[model samples]
Target: MNLEECRKEIDRLDKELTNLLEQRMQVVAKVAAYKKANHMEIFDPRRERQVLDKIAAMAQYKELAPYLQKIYQCIMDESKNYEREYMKL
Candidate 1:
């Protein structure tokens, strides 16, 4: 395809990403509730490691692992913030 087509594809992918992010946040809200009820901490190192490992294994390019990890880190940080707010802790 042409440049415009590629750009449009990116736009479409971005829209999908945005939608997924929103859905993930909703799930995070539930997680916050669960954690609050269970007296769990916001930061779980083992879960983070497992998530990163799974994401890295699904990577199409090994070079993208670091970038993907950073992205997930930021996402998880936001989720933690949400959890804190939800639990008022």
Candidate 2:
């Protein structure tokens, strides 16, 4: 594909990513409510490890595991922050 075509594809993917992120954040809201109801902490290290391991296992590009981990860490941190805000803590 040409440069313009590649850029258009990226733009389309960006829109898709935005939609997915919104959906993910909605789920994060639900998770926060569940945790609060159960008096559970927002940060679950074991779950985080499991998520990272699962992502790493499913990753198509092995070398991108570290990058994916970094992105997921940021996402998890944001989720925790949202939980805190939602809980008014």
Candidate 3:
């Protein structure tokens, strides 16, 4: 494919990613609601570790596996923060 078309594809991919993130946020909001309703903790370190390990296991690049885990950890951290503020518990 041409460079222009490939660039457009990248933009489209980014838009798809943004849409997916919004949907994921909606799910996280629900999780926050449940947590507040049930008096559950917002942060779960074991879950976070599982997430990182899962991502690392799924990574294709050996050198990039840790980076992927780091990025996902950051995303999860922010998501948990959102849950905390949204639930206010």
Task: Write down the TM-score of every candidate.
Answer: 0.88, 0.91, 0.83
Tens-digit lDDT track for model 3 on 1-89?
99999999999999998999889889999999999999999998999888888998898887899899888887898899899899874
Q: Which one is best on lDDT? A: 2
lDDT scores of the candidates, listed in order: 0.91, 0.92, 0.90
Q: lDDT tens string, model 2, 1-89? A: 99999999999999998899889999999999999999999999999999988888889999999899889898899989998998774
Arrange candidates, best TM-score first. 2, 1, 3
The better-scoring model by lDDT among 1 and 2 is: 2
The order by descending lDDT is 2, 1, 3
What lDDT does model 1 reach?
0.91
Which regions in candidate 1 have their CA more than 4 angstroms from the true location? none
Q: What is the alpha-carbon RMSD of candidate 2 to the true structure?
A: 1.4
lDDT of 1 by residue, 1-89 (tens): 99999999999999999999999999998998898899888899999999988888989999999899889989988988888897885
Q: What's the lDDT for candidate 2? A: 0.92
Which segments of model 3 are wrong by more than 4 Å? 1-6
Cα displacement (angstroms), candidate 3, residue 34, comes to 1.1
Per-model RMSD to reference: 1.6, 1.4, 2.1
